[model samples]
Target: MDVKIDSEGAFGSAIVTLEAGEKFVSEAGAMHRASPNMDINVESRRKKMKVYGVHLSLSESNVCR
Candidate 1:
């Protein structure tokens, strides 16, 4: 994988190139565009927490591949 970043002022963009069978992971809403040949998958991870004897579920992160 190859990564290039360009920035102007406070705005920036990244260009990523991937080889076959390689995967890239990023935040769910970070992607602006993708090539037609790229396959994308979104995954969400959740954690179980117990606070004050109460059970709670929280999302850890959203990853895109």
Candidate 2:
């Protein structure tokens, strides 16, 4: 997998290239585009984990910017 980030801050858009059978997870709506052969799937986070009900924990800091 290859990652390229474009911007001058801690948060920016990224382009990723994955080889065959590779996998990646992004924020729920982070994906804006993908290659034609890319396989995209949306699955429940809780179901995938099978241990939690529901939870959302997010933290942001400007220290890296």
Clash-forming residue pairs, model 1: none
Candidate lDDT scores, in order, read 0.56, 0.55
TM-score of each: 0.61, 0.60
Q: Mind giving the per-residue lDDT tens digits that candidate 2 earns over 1-65?
A: 68888655655688776655556777666666765555566665655555322222122321122
The top-ranked prediction according to lDDT is 1
Model 2, residue 28: distance off in Å is 0.6
Over 1-65, each residue of candidate 1 has an lDDT whose tens digit, in order, gives 78888554555778887766666766545677776656666566444742122111112232234
What is the Cα-based TM-score of model 2? 0.60
lDDT of 2: 0.55
- How far off is residue 5 in model 2, in Å? 0.6
| lDDT of candidate 2 at residue 12, scale 0 to 100 | 69
